[model samples]
Target chain A: MNHALVSLACHAYVVAALVYLVYLVRQMDALATGGRVLVGTGLALHAVALVGLFGAQGGRPVGVAQGFSTFAFLLLTIFLVVDVCYRKPVIGAFITPLAVAVLMPGLLLDPGHVMSPDVQRPLLPVHITIALLGVAASAVATGVAVMYLLMERQVKGKRFGLLFSRLPSLEFLDTLNRRLAVLGFIALSVTLVTGAFFSSAAPGFFWTWTSKQIATLVAWAVFAALVGARSFGGWRGRRVALLTMTGFCLLLVSFLSSYDFIHVGGGAH
Target chain B: MEFLCIGLSHRTAPLGVRERLALPEARQVELLQRLAQSPNEAFLVSTCNRVELYMAAPDMNRVRESAREELQQLGGPDALEHLYEHRGEDALVHLFRVAASLDSMVLGEAQILGQVKEAFEKGQGVGAVRGELTRVCAAAFGCAKRVRTETAIGRAATSMASAAVSLASKVFDGLKDKTVLLVGAGEMAELAARHLKQAGATKLLVANRTLARAEALAAEVGATARPYEELFTLLTAADVVVCSTASPVPIFTKENVGAVGKARKHRTLFMVDLAVPRDIAPEVGELDWVHAYDVDDIQKFVAENAAARAEEAQKAGVLVAQEVARFVRDRAVRNGVPVLAQLRQRGESIARAEVERTLAAIGDGLTDKQRKSVEAMARAIVNKLLHEPTARLRSVGPEHEGNRLAGAAAELFGLEEAAPPTGAGGPNVVANGGKG
Candidate 1:
C-alpha cells in the first residue's frame, strides 16, 4: 500500500509538471491554478507515503529509496513555500518538472539498506535530513539560476517570445536565486557539522579523507564561494547564475559519490 | 416612420469642414431640443473626425431635408456637398458599424463607442430618444462590446502612448512600483505620463525649462516638479524616463546615462524620447542598462501594431454583421407583442361576456363551484383559439412580409382603428423608419 501511494504521488507530480508545462506555453490562469492544486495534492500524498515508510522502519528511512523520497518531499515543500510567498507561478514551469524528475528514482527502485543496523546512530536521521534539505535548496537555486540566464538572453537578444513574456524579469530571478543559494549554504553548513558528529558516533564511518568526503568538501566550497561572492563582491547576473549552476552540478556529483560510499562502507558493519 | 443618418466623416469631409459641423455640448442639447419639437427622435454625434445625426421620423424626405438644413446652418454650402445620407436598414447598419469602430478613422479605436454612448445619453436627456432610438442604441452598445471581446480588435496598442506602456511592461515585471521621470512638459510628454500613470507607475517627476509650466502639468498629473538642472539627479532615481523637449540637440549623452547607471547600481532604465530632434542621444541606448526609444521607434511600433489589429478588425466586422442580423430578428419578434396582447384581450373579453350570459340564463341552477369551472374552461378555450395566430404573428420576418402579416392581423381582428397603448408605437416606429 505504501509503495502504491508512492507511485500514485509520483504520477500526480508528473501530471502537475505536465500541466505547468502547458501553462508555460498557453499562459492561462486556469491551467496555472490546476497545476498548483495538483502539485499541492501530490505533496500531501508524498508526505503521507514518507510517514508510512518511516513508521514501518521504526521512525527512520531504511535505505536509499526512502532517503530519496524524503529528499523529494522536502524539495517540493521548500518550492511550494517559495511559490506561495512570491506568487510567481512561472517558476512552477521549472520547479514542478524538476520535482518529478527527482522523485522518479525513489518511486521505481527498491530501497536496499545503505547502513547496517549496528552503525545506525541516533544522529543519522538528523544528519541526513539537514543534508537532503541543503540539496533541495540548492536544486531550487539552480532552477532559478537557469531561468535567470534564459531571461537575460531574451532581454539581450530582444527575442520577446512566449517564454520571454512568461518568465519574470532578470533582476527578479537573480534575486530569488541569490536568496535560495544563501539558504542552501546555511543548511549545508549545519549538515556538515551534524555529519561530522554522526561520523564519530557511528562504528565504521570516519571523517577521514575518503573520496566521498573530498567530493562533499569540494561541493561545500563551491556554494560557500557563491554565497560569499554574491554578498560582498557585487557579483550578479549571468556570472553568478553560471557559478550557481556549476555548484549544483558539483553537489550532484558529491551526492552520488556519498551514495556509493555509504553502500560499500555499510558492508563492513 | 423613416430612419435616416445624414453625416460627414473623415472619408467624405476635410478636417476644416468636419470642425465646422462639430457640435459642442450646449449646441448639441439645442439641436436635440429642436429635433424633439419636430416629433422625430434624433441623436447627434460630433467628434473631431465625424459629425453625424441619426433620426427616426414619419417622413423620410422631410427628415433628410431638415438634417441637411441643420448641417448647412452649422457649416456652409461647402459642407452640403460632402454630406452623405443612409436611410432605413442602411442607417442602422451604419450606426452598428460606428459603435463597433469598424467605421472609425483608426480601424479599431475604442473612443468612438464612448462617444456614441454619450451622444445617446444626451439625446435621452432631452427626450429626443424615446423608445425605438433607445433600443437601437442599446443594441449598438451590446454589439460593440461583443466585438471588443470576441475579436482582437482592441487588443494591441496602436497609439504612441500605449506602445510606450507596452514596451515598459515587456521590460519590467510590473509598473506599480516603478518611478517615472517626465522631461519637458510638452503635450506628448504629458500624454505619455498619463498613460504610464494609468498603467500603475507610482511616482512621477516632471521637469521642464520653465518651473511654472512644469508645476502646472505636475499638479494636473499628481506628480512632483523638479528643476531642469536636476534632470540628471532625477534620472538616477527613475526606472523609466520620458523626454519630449523642444531642444535642438540631445539632452542626455552616453556619459551622463552611464554615470547614472552606476548611481542606480546598474538597474534597468527605460527611456522614451518622443521629441522630434531626439532628446536622448542615440548612443545612450548602447550603454548597459539603458534602453532608449526615440519618436521614430515608437511610431514604427504603433504602425506595426495597427497593421496587426487591422487583421483582427476584419473578424470584428463579421461579428458586427451577425449582431445586426440577430437584432433585426429580435426586433421583428418584439413587434408582434402589442398586437398579440390586444388579440388575447379581445378574445378573453368576448369569452367572458358569453359565459356570463349563459350563467345568468341558468339562474343559479348550477352551484358556485360549477360556475367557476365554467369560467376557467372559457379562458382555456380562448387561449387555445388565439395560440396559432399569436405564434404566426411573432414569427414573421423583419421584411415586408412581417409588416403585411401584422397589418392583415390588425384589420381582421378589428384592431386597426383601436388606439394603441402609449408605448406600443416603438416597434412600428423602428419598422417603418428602418425599412427602405
Candidate 2:
C-alpha cells in the first residue's frame, strides 16, 4: 500500500475517535451523527487499505489481517446497532472509546509478518477466526459489565442522572453478560479444540507449559465457571459482571501473548 | 389569574361521597359547560379516585364560591370540607406536580396522564377549557412523561394491569392452572388479560359488549372470544373475573354472579371491578369465597406502594420541584418578551416624534435625502439604545429590579393582561399556548 493512503486512513481513524469522544461529552445530535458517519467512512477506508494490501502481498497476509479486522468491525457494528436499538445512546460513550483504541493501534501496527507455506493452512484460519470472535464477545461482555456496575451503583445510591437514565438496568445487563459469555465460551472452546487437533504433536506438546496456553486455559476455565455457576447456582448481577471482566482480562492477555509466542502471520496494516 | 382546584379525591372523601360527586361520562360535557358559566377556564378530571374541577379565573373569591356551590349540587353543600383549593403560584405548582404524576394517588403513575388527557378533550368539547387551564393540563402531561423517562420511578412499579394480576394471585394460590375471564374489551380489561396470560394462567375468555372488539382483544392476549351472553357461563368456569367496560349500569350483580358461583360448587372467584360507576354490586364482597375488590381497593394498594416508597417519592418530589422552578424561571423571562417589544415600540415612537420635530426646526440646511438619512439614523439609534436592556431582560431574576421594571412596562403598555405567551410551562409547553 502507498504511504499516502495508509496515512490518510490513519488520520481518518484519529478524527473518528476524537468525534466519538465529543459525542461522549456533548451528546449533541449533530455531533453523534457526525461521529457515526466519520467512523463508517474510516471503516470503508480501512477496508480499501486491506484490499490494497491483499493485492500487493498476495492472499495469506490478507486473510490473517482480515480476520482480526473483521472481528473489530463486527464489534463496532453491534455497538452502533445496539445504540440505535436501545433508546439510550450513552452506552456508545463506553463502546466508541474501546473501538477508537483498537482502531488507533490497528492502523499504526505493522501487519508485515510472514508465515511459512507449511504453517499456512485451512485449520489456522479456523483457529484465528474462532479466537478473534471469542475475544470480541469477551470485549462486549466486559463493556456491558462495566455499564451494569456503574448503573447498579447509581441506582443503589439513588444519584440519578443522564447516565442513570441511559444505561440498562442491572437485570438486563446481567442477562446480556451471560448471553455474551456463553457465545465467548463456545467460540473459545472451538478455537482451543481445533488448535489442539491441528498442532501435529500430542496434547502435552501443544500445551508445553507456555504462557499463551496457560492464559488461554485460565480464561476458558473462568468463563466455564461463570456459565456453570449461572446455570446451576443462579449466580447473577454483580457476581456475573465481576466474573465477565475477569475472563475478558485473561482473554486479552491470552491474545497478546499468543501473537508474541505462536509466531502467527500478520496482514493488512 | 387565580386558580382554584376543588373536588373529592380518594384521600379526602369516602367512596360514597366520591360516587355521589362522580361526573358520569355522559354528563361530562354538560358539567364542563356549567362550570364554564362563571367566566372561568374550567376542566374536569374524573378518574375512579379523583373527581377534580380545575378552574382558572381572574376572580379567586368568586370562582371558589361558585366552584363550591357547583360541587354542592352533588354532595349537598358538605363537600367543601373535603375539597382543597390552591391559588397563584401554589396552584400553578400543584397542577404541574399533578400532571407530572407527583400528586397522583399512585406516585409516578401513567394512568392519571391519560385521565387528564380525557378531561382536556371533554372540556374542549364543551368549550369550558381555554387559556391557563388548558395550558396547565397539557403541561402536566408533558411533565409526567419527562419524569417517567428521566427517573427510576417506574422500575418494578406495579401497573394497574400487574396490580390486578397480583390481586388475583393473592385470591388464588397459583394461576398456573386457573382460568381468567376478561369481561369487556376496554383498556384495563385488555391489560389485565395480558397480565393473566403472562402469569401462566391456563385459559382466558374475553366477553365484550361487541363481539368484534372482544375477538380483537382475545386474539392479542391469546384468549378465547365469547359472546356477552356467555359471560355467566364463562364466569362459572373461571377463577378470576376482571370487569372493565363503558356500560352505564352495573354489568355484574349479586343475582347474576351469585348463581354462577353456586353453580361452580362454591369455588372461589376473584372479582376485580375496574369500572367508573362500579361494575359489580358492593354486596358481592360478602360471599365467603368470592373475593371482590373494586377500583377503590386498587387505590388502597397504590397508596400502600406510595407509602412504602415515600423516601423515593421525596427524591422524585425534589426533582419535580427543581424542574418546576427551572420552568417557571424560564417562563417568567419569556413573559417579558412581549412587554419588552411593546416598551421598545413605545420608546421608539417617542424618540421618532422628538427627532422629527428637531429636524424640522433646522429645515433650512437639510436636503430631502439628508432628512431621509437622518430618519434612518434616528431609528438605528433607538434600536442600539434598547438592545442591551432587551438582552438584560431575558436574564432578569424574580428578585431583581429588572423584573419590576418589566412588570411596570407590561402594566403601562397593557401587555401584562395580554393573551398567554405561546409556550411557557412543562417541557412540551409548545403543545399548549405557554400560559403555564
True contacts kept of each: 0.16, 0.00
Q: Write the per-residue lDDT of candidate 2 for residues B90-158, one digit (tens) a residue.
A: 666676777666676667666667778888888877778765566566666666777777776656464
Best by lDDT: 1
Off by over 4 Å in 2: A1-269, B34-40, B59-61, B125-138, B359-389, B398-405, B412-436
lDDT of 1 by residue, A101-183 (tens): 88887776655444444544677667667777888888989999999878776655555566766888766787888898888
The worst-scoring run of ten residues by lDDT in candidate 2 chain A lies at A260-269
Which segments of model 1 are wrong by more than 4 Å?
Answer: A56-63, A112-118, A200-207, A210-235, A261-269, B1-158, B246-250, B275-277, B280-288, B291-312, B315-436
List model 1 lDDT by residue over B178-225, tens digit each.
889999996666778788988998799999999998999999889999
lDDT by residue (A138-231, candidate 2, tens digit) is: 8888898998888656544334355554455455576677888999999989978987876644345655766667888899999999999988
